[model samples]
Target: MKVLPRQRKAVLINSVLGVAVLAGAGGAYSAVTSHSDSSARADARTVTVAKGTVLATVSGSGSLSSPSDAGVNFTTGGKLTQVNVKPGDKVSRGQLLGKVDATAAKETLAQDEASLTAAQANLTKVQEGQPSTSTGSGSGSGGSSSRGSANTAPTPTPSPTVDPAQLAQAEAQLTQAQNAVDAAQRAVDGTTLRAPVAGTVASVSAKTGDTVSGTGGNSTAGGSGGGSASGSNSGSTSSGSSSALSGFVVLTNPSGMQVTANFSEADALKLKPGQAATVTLNAESGTVLNAKVLSVSSLPVSSGSGSGGGGGGGNSSGSAVQYAATLTITSPTSNLRTGLSASIQVVTGEASGALSVPTAAVSGTGANRTVTVVNDDGTTQRTPVTVGLEGDSADQILSGLSEGAKVQLASVSASGNGGFPSGAFPGGLGGGAGRTRGGGAGGAGGGFRTGGGGGGRG
Candidate 1:
């Protein structure tokens, strides 16, 4: 058959256009299918409810501290003469840590002792008989002296009597002198620093020959006398300028090592003394220690001015109120040190041998809690459930679905979008070819039909 060049060229162009249209349609269909497959993979999976144990725990981060941590300081200011202990030295209660020069103190004591001795002697004389220089005039003696001139012998003065008033004055003076002597002795003793409690020296800020004002760091170790979070503002040795660590020496009772953590108000309310707790050190993640809640502070961490807690364990930032909690390590290791960061988990509630399901399968809370049950017929139904002891991995199901009942896990992706691209052009090439044949195709349908038919028939 003979064909003109112009006609042939038109036919060739139509054939190419038709092939392009088919290729576009195929690509669109493949994209939609791939997206649907990924969405399915991201969807929910079914799990059977069964009997298990669930532990409800309140978790928080904190730091290691010792209730028996004491900041040893000199009671009176003087030149530091001797330091017997350094950091890491073990000492007993009343052990002398260091001393300031006691020369002036000794001098004061000597003067007070002399005064006390003089006062004692004066008191003794008053109690016996105070010598009276005043002569007593007697009527008989006066008459005799008037009659017999100088020959009348002066009657011997009666033996001196102790005046009650004079005795009382002397006793009072003695008491005053005794008190002064005791005070002087205490001043002399105050020149030396002693450990208030038995513990290891955690740090020493003062050295021999340094003059200390003795104005700060007078806190007693074992604060408040129990296993309670003192929330002390003690700073770590990591910072040199911290005044909290600026004591003569920092003493820590290694045996009293405990953890101090802060919990939100919601969690704090659920915590109480004697609750079982677990502590994990931040530096040693694998080391787990058993402990129990020793105390929970009634006031927020920010509200208290406690100088008892070691390391800034409680959270004082943010608008939320955080309560300090103390946990005692039942079996502490020798390696445990104050100011070490740790995470705490206290078991607040527990349920055993109860019907439970994966926590992810449950939605909502309280009386309105619900789960999606997967029926045997492949249908899903939203069912209300009564839950108890909502744990980390699983939740206790009190009712609404028997044991062995299956529930669908919550989907990661949203549902009900028709499995199609939302922003795709309306009735465009993908949609047009997807919905109709050549004559009713979308995206310039009439032109596509003409070129498409010619390419197909050819």
Candidate 2:
């Protein structure tokens, strides 16, 4: 304790250096322990890479609809006298369903027939050189003038003396009469509602004693002989003059059933007609329908509140604007009901027996994907990978990976080399979504005849 000041100062400096050395060693140990703990957590996220099948698919939800959904309306409205069929009744072409009051239609036909007869009689008189009654008086006066001159009746003009205006009027009248008759006949035919095709009646919107019009909601301006109403065949009203029709009948073709699914504009454009797909019914879990893309609408289906379905009852909600596409069911379509909820998964791309790893195991996006390869010695090494298809669950390795390699899912924080964080699994890769492949080779030339793709969702 009685040491010189210089001696004490040297001892103090030595002691301070010893403390500093001890602190540095403790800090290094703590750093090492932190790194070890992070590694342990990452091991839990490790997944084994293997060779298998992967399916790249597009999915959307929609309701089952009829490829030939038709709404029936009367050619002309009248008091409904009879309803021969009920909803769900099967009908065939020309099959009579019901009739409206034909009293007015019959009267109209009779009037047109009488008018046609008058026009024909007049036209015949003029054609046969007989002076028409309308022109007879003028001719008689002309004859009187000839007599007053003490001269023989002026030689009747060699040419037939026919009034052009009268002749034209007669011809126009005949045509009008004929058209009137045709329209009246068409109205009569419309009075008796008939099936345009063999199908199950989905709905009957008319009843006896109800007054109806000639045009229905789904009718065209040229209400031809199609759907439940007709324009060309049954004679339709002009759009300007058409009135709301009653007696509505909806028919669905039993042989043809299709699904109408809505997707975003971007997704819809990715689909093409003839892409293979599978449809699963939400109501009947066991039912699966194999289908092919029949059409992809260039324009989104014009929608309303989605009120009426081909099956008669439809949902009125979820009216979001979306592009509509169709898939025709090729499988046995028995027991399928319209308006049933369905999910369709269309395979966009697929590959079989390709080297692959869990999608979560691949870190980074696009071309910079990296994987923490688990070494045999219980350690990890960051490895760059050339990923081909980043599937829903696993990714296809174009290069930089091999079968049976274990890798940890990426969960880095701050720096890119932060290793895996503490958690259970990563990005739903292990949550039993079934294995799905991702990515496409961007038009890699191949034919359906070559590569064996995995079956799409069922």
Candidate 3:
């Protein structure tokens, strides 16, 4: 029982060392628990419902063209004597675009006039019953007696009789001559090329002294869709050049500018005439035009380049089906041209000052939509909701949710486990926690859009 001072000191040192070891272990355990909790919370994102504007739109890429585009050319083949217009020049209907040499046309017309005059005289003489004047020898026996009896009576001269067949033949010849003269006059007039409509000259294929083959018969009145708006006429030529132009001249009416775009079959179903649209030009990135849906093609245009799937007969060739839609630019610009690349956004549905939530927070279809509501006590409850105007980033909440209600984004599973991991979640799909810009569920700022487009700030 007799303990030494050194022995007590050693015992006390051992006790302190053991206590220190336990304290260190406890601290490490606490740190690990805290990290695990934080990681779990990071996978969950919460947002508040608010009143905002939500828009549903269908988008597609296309090109600008004018419905009032036309191609002009000479009707009669000859050397071009004049070219009065160039690309970008404003012209009116009947404005002289160019002229071919009319010398040969005039000469032909003169010859026709001479033939017509001779035919007319011959017809008049025939109608008047004019007879040929000829000398005749008298018969010997009776003639001598008659000649001696000249004092008795003068032989009565008979009036010439018109031949019915001769008159008909002469009249027909006159008619033929008249027709020739009229045709000659038309040929002379055809030497001049004129604008078929009021428009800006888009291209010129010929110039003074250029020999044109007279493509007048194929000239168009510059109607929409039928013109060179497809850039088929974008090729050009200069004055006196020997190369073939799309036509003698190409013209387009800027006032009649429109855009043609292709949309997926799903998006196409939502498109209708008179739907408002926004058009952005690829050439001028900053420029946007106000437009409306002019028409949506009822038939689908099949393409072999699409990823094989869906209603377009996408078989093994990777083909896709798309429908063509036309939009008329209400706010047109003077510089609009055919073949300008454009992006179109047509507003199919819109809701203003409506209660809304992020698209990611809502799940299920139509009447079965549901959201997870986060209570003040940190518990979540499944709440059914009515959705209207489903947009890209946000959806309009019609009922079962109110402004300022906190809601948790629904969890999407991958690998059959309840967890958020890479490669399992596609951005903009249900419940991978990330903040989106533009009409986001958080009601940050910008107009909310939905429908057949990807999600981001826009």
lDDT (CA) for every model shown? 0.68, 0.63, 0.69
| Tens digits of lDDT, candidate 3, 1-458 | 97669989899999999999888866755554455445555567799999989988878888877656666566677898888999879998778887889999999999999999999999889888965564444445544554555455434555667999999999999999999998788778878877766787867866788787754333333312212211211212221111212467776666667888999777888999999999999889899999999999999876656432111111234345789998889994687766788999999898999999988798777699999899999888989999888876789998999889999874423112223222122121222223332212221111122111222222
Runs of candidate 1 with Cα error greater than 4 angstroms are: 1-44, 124-168, 206-210, 213-243, 302-318, 375-384, 412-458
Number of the top lDDT candidate: 3
Residues 1-458, candidate 2, lDDT per residue (tens digit)? 67669989999999999999889866755664478556556445677888888766777778776544455677667788988889879887778877778898899889988988888898877666644233223236434444345445333334557778888877888898888887778777767777666677766776788776665223453233323354212322212111222126666663567887877554676688988899999888888889888888788754444331111122334343457788888987666766778998887667799998876576666788788898899788889999886565677988887888888764432122222121111221111111222221111111212221221211
Relative to the true structure, candidate 2 has a C-alpha RMSD (angstroms) of 14.3
Q: Which ten residues in a row have the lowest lDDT in candidate 3?
A: 443-452
Local accuracy of candidate 1 as per-residue lDDT tens digits, 1-458: 87669989899999999999989987876776567657755565999988888987888789887656666566556888999998879998778888889898899999999999999999998887945566645447435445445555466665678889999999999999999998788777777777767778877766788886543233343222111111122222221111233366767765667888998677889899999999999999999999999999999985433221111112223355679998888875577877788999899989989999977688775688999998999788999999887776788998897998999986533233234432132232222111111112222122122221111000
* Shift of residue 417 alpha carbon in model 3, Å: 3.3
TM-score of 2: 0.62
